[model samples]
Target: MIRLVKVSKSYGDTIAVRQLSLVVNQGEVCVLIGPSGCGKTTTLRMVNRLIEPTAGRIFINGKEISRVKPEQLRRSIGYAIQSVGLFPHMTVADNIAVVPELLHWAKSRVAHRIDELLRLVGLDPLEYASKYPNQLSGGEAQRIGVARALAANPPILLMDEPFGAVDPLTREKLQAQFLRIQQELKKTVLLVTHDLDEAIRLADRIAIMASGRLVQHATPEEILSRPTNKFVHDFVGTDRALKRLSRIGVASFIRPTHSVKLSTPMKEVASVCERCHWVWVVDDDGKFTGWLDRTSLPAANSVRQAMVVGDRDEITITKNATLREALSRMLGQGFNSIPVVDEEGRLIGEVSLGDVEAATAKMEP
Candidate 1:
């Protein structure tokens, strides 16, 4: 929904952005990232007219943004920054109500918007509404800044290092929460950050910038697997392979197999294991119970009585877990295979070493 065509920005003798061109599709999250002073932020600011481009055209939806009044254009787009910049004198509720009030919304509507935004960002409105910015933590204030920007339900969002000021743990939480919110809201987003990890985690498409120019624009997986040049490869770093795994899920590699019930006789367990080295055991309810080792079956009565069940001693990958998680668990525990389970701990399938190896090979350059 946003497009920049041959956009460039200069401040006296220095060029902040070169003739950059890019398009952020409707509801896509596009991240701009690179080294310091590479014009990523400048490109982001140009979209919202925070830093007017000296040359080239910009568009939001279909109309040229340069043709619209600055104030009108900005109000239609949400903006957030590293500093958060919440008004200390205003209550959290009032701070979030800023944009709505500016747009001449009724007091009741503003109040309702404030409450809805707070809840949307995972904050308790009743508890946080009356508090001033000074009374909140850095993370809380940052959340308020986002809520304020989104108060008008703008279809486009411009963010510049929005999570940079928070601690690492808080930053991760915020990124995850923002991703969840984005999935639900689907606003066309243009975010600027120098952190590659952040770009990989949050962006649908990453635009790598260098020396005031757009170097490459591709999906996170594409960029990681097939960087266009030495500059792009070095910028993405050597850990790109590991990062790619974090984008795929365990379900992509899971293999279906036969499962044994805990109530099954030891002889039956051994018979089931005749073709395989091991058998996964489940309870009467089909919840993952444990596994039956071929060597231990002949010495016991039932699968439940003979099963080796001390925490199962088996690594498990949740369906929602990334392939990186599965790989890490397998490598860390030195296991040949790992179980794949659902959220409720029911076994669904198994992931083998071969599965991980094949997936990694497919993603390699």
Candidate 2:
């Protein structure tokens, strides 16, 4: 939905971006990533006219953006940054209400929008509404920044290092939340970051920049497996094979399997998984409880007694989890196979280390 055609920006003798051209498809995230000085942020800023391009044109949906007033353009396109840039003096509600209020939305409509946005970003509206920016945690503040950005329900979002300032754990949570939100909102997004892992995790397409020029722009799998040049290859790092796993969902590799019920006879459970190393055990409700080691099955009377509950929570991957996450869980917990569960924690399928092995092996150089 957004297109940049031969866009370039210069500062005196230096060029921030040079004849860069890219298209961010409708309802897809396009991440711009590179080294520190590679103009990823400059490209992002130019989209919202925060930094006017020295040359070339930007178009949104079919019309050129230059025709629109900067304030109007910004209001129509959501913008969030690394610094959060929230007004410290304003209450969280007032801060989120900034854009809607600017647009002269009705008082009732603005109030509803404020609460809706806060909830959408995982904050308690009633509790957080009166809290000022200074009163919030880093993660909470960033979420508020996002709520403020989405106050107007814009179809396009421009983010420049939006998750960079938060700690790694918080950053991961934010990224996952953004992915869920994106699935629901389907906004055309252009995000800038220096972290390749973040790009791999979040991007539908990646634009790699080098020394103020567009080096390569493609899907993460293509960029990882078929780098256009040495720079692109090196920039993506040596762990490209494992990185490709991040783009694949666990569902794609899940093998349909049976789970023994808690009331099932131990002998029956052993027979059911006679050829397997372990069998997943579920409760009467079919909710996953744990797994049973076949080797321990003969001496056990019930599924509960012999069930190997070795950090099952830590080793479990949701059906929607990336294969990389499954692999990481396995490696971290020394698991041969990890059970896949639905959102309700019911066993759906399982992914093995061999599953990831086979996937990467098929794509091997």
In terms of TM-score, which candidate is strongest?
2
- Evaluated at residue 210, the lDDT of candidate 1 is 93
In TM-score terms, candidate 1 sits at 0.77
Candidate RMSDs in order: 4.7, 2.6
* Model 1 lDDT per residue over 282-320, tens place: 888777777777887777777877776735324666676
Deviation of model 2 at 5, angstroms? 2.9
Question: Per-residue lDDT for 1-365 in model 2, tens only?
Answer: 99999999999999999999999999999999999999998999899888899999999998899998899899879999989999989999999998989999999999999888888988888899999989999899989888888889999999888888888868878998999899999999999987888999999999999989999999998999899999998888899889998888888789987689889987788788877877888878777787787888778888888887544467677887888889998898787788888878788888999999998998857
The lowest-lDDT stretch of 10 consecutive residues in candidate 1 is: 308-317
lDDT of 1: 0.85
* Local distance difference test, each candidate: 0.85, 0.88
* lDDT score at residue 316, model 2, on the 0-100 scale: 74
Highest lDDT, which number?
A: 2
* Residue pairs that clash (backbone atoms under 3 angstroms), model 2: none
